[model samples]
Target chain A: MARERKFSLNEVFQHTKQLLLEHGYEGFTFGLLAERLGVSRTAIYKHFENKEEVITAYMVDEMEQVFAKFVHIHDYPTFDEQFRFLLNLILYHDDLHRMIAIGRRIPDTTPAVRANKERLEQFHERMYEELNQLVERGKQEGRIKPHLPNRIVLAYIFQSVVVPHFPGISLDQWAESIKEIIMYGVMTGN
Target chain B: MARERKFSLNEVFQHTKQLLLEHGYEGFTFGLLAERLGVSRTAIYKHFENKEEVITAYMVDEMEQVFAKFVHIHDYPTFDEQFRFLLNLILYHDDLHRMIAIGRRIPDTTPAVRANKERLEQFHERMYEELNQLVERGKQEGRIKPHLPNRIVLAYIFQSVVVPHFPGISLDQWAESIKEIIMYGVMTGN
Candidate 1:
């Protein structure tokens, strides 16, 4: 029978994510999670098989939320705004760092990570296409520079500061700084 | 007495570094290391108190090689040439991705890692100071931009690409495209 606990699945997940953020992957023990949630260790197992399962669930859920933000980015007016969004999305967001860390640390020898890489790469490629289109639109609208190749610039910015370790820096701040550098290099008419 | 091994210390170290590169900190075993080096595990113990010691030694050796290059950078005669030398020192010649992966995977809560981080941070600071000097000199020579702060630009580049993931891309040529991006971004004339 399902542990007729006081907590719901989403509630447990939310709590687990908080723990993962407060503590890291290793610190999220079943005992502490159970104690923190005012439930037995068995209750956690009822919802998830292992710590790996819970951590994986949390990371993927976070990734989905980040992807959701990317999907809705076009809602912003102006390529300059969208450009700001792209640079920020790569730099300060916790989701990007978490995902990239997961990608790098997890052994690719495993079938599990290899399979996961497919979805991850697909998501990245789609996002790149969206960003490329945004820059293209900016150029046509006389906002971004026309001469720089779409993919090259995208990869340049992406690789430059994508997996940021600095937590306090804001997206607008980083975007503005990089925009000045790129502004000197590229023509993004303010 | 030290084991009269057929292989030299250099040979043993080469094997150890290779094993760490392929398998990572977790995957590497004392038994496996001995087996690859064609020595008894006891002999290995004589050389390194633990695997961590070996890894630490490897890093120290690697940094020494990089530092040796730094001394000769003045020979290059142009800031761009010097930039290329610095780039190769940090990104090209090192198995840096492995070190980065190892660094990220270890939580600061771990006692060993916490202690290791102090030394690592000091090393990073020294390198950063030297790099800032290089960039500043480049600016004076009109080879690198004056507008960007060396701390932000060099730190970002070092963190992003100079660093590496264990068992990931180890080839220097792999970073050619990234070097191109950074070259353009930091160039004064751009």
Candidate 2:
């Protein structure tokens, strides 16, 4: 009888994220992934044909997890509360933006890869649609400036995900400071 | 008699920037540069041994031009005036951020390239020093918030260089809006 080779999909995805973040798209490989998984290459091969398949799958999983939670933004009673919740969520998934950029560079070498890429793009559209509602709500409440284009406002908020971490600042402080800056900017008079 | 091959340093640097922007550092080539310059490959080889030397030389020229203007920030008198001047200058050189990032990836393979890279790094530090003075002045003037770290404030300003252009908006309007947002944020109450 052949020995059993057992590993959960969650474990595989955790390792995928780690490797992709550590090595980027170019450096990610099945050999390294298999080693990290503590399993034979055959066991890994049983699920995916190539690195692109694995990465795309990981991205899809990530998008699903993120958007699932993002759907609850409407649950917040006010635009201000919703804005804070959104920023906090975005900050929590700090690596998502980098991951999405990496995903764009992944070639559609196979049908499976192509399909996963399409799914990721759909998730992206859904995300922007969700954010747009928040922008609309802010406008309705007269919180956001009227003349500002919606896209610029969205770009500013999205750009916050890339703000460099400062030493001696806690994550909560960083998020709060960024939220304050986004809402009122650096001017003390504001 | 051999034909003369003549091209100015300015012309060469212009083509260098164009090619670097189009193909990135990895795809940049003397062959392509010669094609763009309408000169023989030997003409380029006559000036620099490799692509790295030419690129580093071009980057050094760019830094000199930018910093020459940056030095005059002190002439603005007030912190508000100085801040506006700095943002306008930065917005004008929109590609500078991308060029500087490409410069960082250039390997120090030769002595000439190594020297040029060091010069670029010094220019970068000098730039931060200049910006730091502006930040301090703003704080002293009670314009910028006191508790915020200097780096975050600087990062926010620098990141504006990457903001996507909105269709149908004039550059003047765009710059003014960005300056307004940076100072007072998107909040109407401010």
Candidate 3:
């Protein structure tokens, strides 16, 4: 009888990702990975040329997801819903340590850092366009202030939640506070 | 007569700051730094233990200036002036890359990365307190609208600037646009 194949390649890649998320760059050394997998390092070699290649593949995949999310973020039904999504990313975002490691794994600050900053940067336009559209829609529907510039409003909401602006707060608190401000600003201007 | 000292340690450290600001963190290596000082690596070592120690000192010193400026930020006599100082950091805050590096520099996610996360997270509060005081004062003076909580205002002003919700813009432009939003929120109801 032919020898049975052990684990599928996707399974191997998933295992590698767990090791990376748990171990970080140093933790994901080839020896340790093979030991973790109970397979020869050569088995890993069959799938990946080296450790960097494996990790880089994982990172590229993650970057692709971040970009795809950027495109699909506007699919949420309402501006409030969109703001909620942003808040989820900002206050909690990933395990900051894990995400930071992901950042370090990339090379170069100017060009993609390992994947693509330009693509990531342009992702904002989609967000802005949707935000502007929402605000215009809100104005028409009498849900938002007529005076608010959709672009500026969108920028404000996006900036606060994504970057480290407030310290020692959870995403829930961050979202609640932003919604509060926007609520007050657009209300009562008579 | 005793031979004159070539250059003081303080002088060397000062020049290192100038270089780091000009070249950025990736390009700011010890070899280049030593070359700039016209000294050997050994001589540089005599004064400092390593590159990180140098960087920590420079960054901490920069943070000190920022902190001091915030203390006096409210002394600017008007909301517009105080807002100007706030925007200065967001819009023209040079060395953010280095700041990010110092806070998020660990290559792999590990205990060291955890340690860095705490350090970076703490840095956020340094500015929050300053903004909080201003918001409290703004509300008491009735210059800021009473409907919004100071904490909420402080949080919104900060979060919106860093991770911007939109794409296709420079951080500076995003910050500038958000600055307007903050000002608009406090404006005499139009």
Candidate 4:
């Protein structure tokens, strides 16, 4: 028999993230995961009951890391700086966007999936609250348009990260262009 | 033996689109498709060699429809009106976005897939050309910011369609909010 390797929750989460990104939710399987981890399928079963449980645990862990970043927004002085930080965070963590898409498609059948969904909702609420605060501050500072609803601004900022990367443009160029478009309207002078 | 129902190319295209949207590319299969259409597997085989061929054909047809809409841009008076029409078309055809996502994941293994990819690229090129014209006109007319690059503006317009729909907000509200942000921006003063 092959020697059984020890694995921590962090190891499991990292591998899960990689698997999810590589194959998406549909292709993710315990057998593939165990093979990748150099362990028996029973080893994985010891950690989670099913694929849904593994995915839910991984998502919950990822959300906590994202929440931590949101909590640190208070350290930034200007709304623009805060906004930039948030944008960079989203752009760098491309996996989060893919995960969100996959998560939406996963059927919420098990109790673990339902609980994870609730936790995900809570994370979203917290993120939105922080975003609202940033927008309100931007309005007060005259950095953001006061006329636009907070929700609209919130959605605009969130959507900026997912802008399709044009074939010819470099990543740095794409990031700068998106940031500028979000900050200033594409319209010319008044 | 039961009498076979005759189906047109258009019928196959339409039903294939419905299947791709409902089950995604992975779940889509000739067996399911034939059953859904109340036809035998061999009937579908007569039209398509495999799922890839069906998808490519469906995509080509859909792109032609989209391109036809692009061709009518000259009928609109203002760039803003033209922009709204494009946005509305994309927003209402939610399947287009989903199909694009699913299409990207489909492996290209055959001549049909390659040909379809080329046609899709051509459609994109045409769309981008039209978008560039609109952006240039918007700038000349003092509607769009003169400093922003055409590519940036193009990305912004395309990205607007995929903005996450905020919970509790009506579709009209979401549409209006996105339009305002893209035009006036979230910033308060010029």
Candidate 5:
């Protein structure tokens, strides 16, 4: 009967994200998570050993979701279409960048968390590989300059998310502006 | 007389920067600083009450130096020329960005450090003012797109320094490439 409880990993991750965003890694606690989820601390403990386990699990889950969407970039045709799709995708997952940073600081004291961290690192490497392929595609199509290094081009694209959101702008407009800046820069093109 | 001491603020700040970069703000201590400077802790204490005071003072001094040079952006006539000058200066003072971040984390426990922190903040505001002026000039001269918001353009330029240094590339080349990317972007413009 205890195994048939409503304790779901999806619900747990939803609260985990909220607490992590609000309190950060150091401030996050199982007690706080339980309160937010409207469940007993024991319910959470039943699923995970500690806060690190929950956080690591949440981060891995987020990464997997992002990776799933990223692999779909091939569905979009042309370099510009793919680039726009990528810019929108990155902007949508803006919070994940902060979470990724927090993930790096998680201690590897527990075997579960350590294994999750290793898996997260592999996902990170694969993401970079995906980006590399995107750059290669752009170069092959002659959309990007031939002389520019793939790393620099890739870095420029990744840094776009760090640009803070300006007031009075919707997300679509913001992503469109960044796409324009990334492709043609601020020049008038005279 | 006691006035005839080898301890100089210039030497102190130079070593402070090195130590902060090496060990970060938390790892830095007066003992390590004194040992590296070949001076007694008492000698250093004569000039500073604590580590916070030293770090804050060094940060203010660095900001002032950068500000002094930044005011000369008007020396260059063209918009692109001024932009390039600003880019190189920002890149040259790249370590200052990390130091500025460390400066923010210093506790405001002393009057001297607190005063320095305020002054450092003023310098930060003035730097942004300078950047805003640069963007205004570009727009007025019809070089940069008038449709682009100044904040996005400025953020894009500032974020350029965060790009990792690719191996085998000199600083001059790196700055040049970034300048190109900022002005023309990676597109071939065909």
Candidate 6:
């Protein structure tokens, strides 16, 4: 008789992320996941009790990867360069943007969901702290406005990542346009 | 015997919009809609063939209302005033934003769905045309940058409407911050 294959935790997370991105929360199912993983339903259930657990695990992993990218922001010489790098990273990672946009809609009633939410919050808090540091640096370096609230600035920066892409525009052009619009107001003072 | 109550088309559209905003597309169903409207499922089916039809109809109605608001943009003296007015209107109308965000996920294989999509496209085209005119006016008035494409400016404006609200900040503050960030940017020259 042929032996059944075993899957690793990393393998499970990779497939789960793909499934969530492809099907969204509503269409994802443990049965479909098991089938995709080439394993029996019981085999997959042995690892995760329910769909929420898998989803939470996937999000945690993805968030960690994203957080790691922020560590290198300081490596850039100027705040403008750092900001542009961050913007390009976010624009290219469409899956991550979609995941963040839809993350709030995930039902979080269970303990696992609560844990996931807490971890996500921590990541956000850390991100905001890093962002604050950058804004302070920008202010000192004469790159950021002094009077604007840090929170509002952060919101605008984060929001730019999710800006809708126009049809027929190349990604490079879109990125450049977005950077210009954000860095300089649309208004052209005569 | 007393006469039975009959729901009008407008009533159906209003209730459908409410359900969509409350439960999102996944939770919306004809059975639930009928129960909320005090009508049988058969009665709902008599007017709309499926959930897509109901959603498309609701979107069409809502889009028409939003489009109608653009007519008076010229009433404002300056493009800046008109821009702020439009921004505030979009920010306040949370339901419309939610509907537009969720509208893309609706499946549209049926003829009814296709028809609804066409109508929506027409409304979008009209709105874009109006926005372009505003952009031209802004350029002539020296408010908007002369070099920026109209589409990029429009994308930036629309994206601001859906910017995530920060915790603990009042809506008024958020709006002011966004306007300032968009108008003057985060950089300081001094």
| Each candidate structure's count of clashing pairs | 4, 0, 13, 9, 0, 2
| lDDT of model 2 at position B70 | 91
Ranking by lDDT: 2, 5, 4, 6, 1, 3
Deviation (Å) of B27 in candidate 2? 5.0
Instruction: Encode model 5's per-residue lDDT on B13-40: one tens digit a residue.
Output: 9999998866667668999999988988
- The RMSD (Cα, Å) of candidate 4 is 3.5
Ranking by DockQ: 6, 4, 2, 5, 3, 1
lDDT of 2 by residue, A13-64 (tens): 9999998767656668788998998888777888898889999998999999
State the weakest 10-residue window (summed lDDT) of model 6 chain A. A181-190
Reference-based lDDT, residue A126, model 2: 85
Native interface contact recovery, all models:
0.07, 0.51, 0.19, 0.65, 0.62, 0.62
Candidate 5, A46-163: lDDT as tens digits: 8799999999999999999999999899899888888878878887887877687578778887899999999999999998998888889889998988787888888777766767
Candidate 1 falls in which docking quality class? incorrect
Model 2: residue A55 alpha-carbon error in angstroms: 4.9
What are the per-residue Cα lDDT tens digits for candidate 4 across A128-157? Answer: 887888888888888877767788777677
What tens-digit string does per-residue lDDT give for candidate 3 at B14-97? 777777655544446788778777877677766566665555555555666566666777568886577678766655544444
Whose lDDT is greatest here? 2
- Local accuracy of candidate 3 as per-residue lDDT tens digits, A60-144: 5554565556555567877557555654553443433344335454454332243443443354455456556756766676655
Ten-residue segment with the worst summed lDDT in candidate 4 chain A? A180-189
Ranking by TM-score: 6, 4, 2, 5, 1, 3
TM-score, chain B, each candidate: 0.70, 0.94, 0.56, 0.82, 0.91, 0.82
Chain A alone, TM-score per model: 0.60, 0.92, 0.50, 0.84, 0.89, 0.81
In model 4, the clashing pairs are: A144-B188, A145-B186, A145-B187, A145-B188, A186-B145, A187-B144, A187-B145, A188-B144, A188-B145
Q: Taking the candidates in order, what DockQ does each have?
A: 0.18, 0.44, 0.23, 0.58, 0.42, 0.59
Candidate number that wins on TM-score, 2 or 5: 2
- Cα TM-score per model: 0.70, 0.81, 0.58, 0.84, 0.78, 0.85
- The residue-by-residue lDDT of candidate 1 on A47-131, one tens digit each, is 6766656655555666677788887687788666777776667665644554455444444444544555656667767876787
State residue B72's C-alpha deviation in candidate 3, in Å: 3.5
For residue B24, give model 1's deviation from the true position in Å: 4.7
Candidate 1 ranges beyond 4 A from true positions: A1-42, A104-122, A132-153, A162-175, A179-190, B6-32, B35-42, B97-123, B141-143, B160-176, B186-190
lDDT of 4 by residue, B40-123 (tens): 998887767788988988998998987787678778887778877877776766567667766777777778888998888788
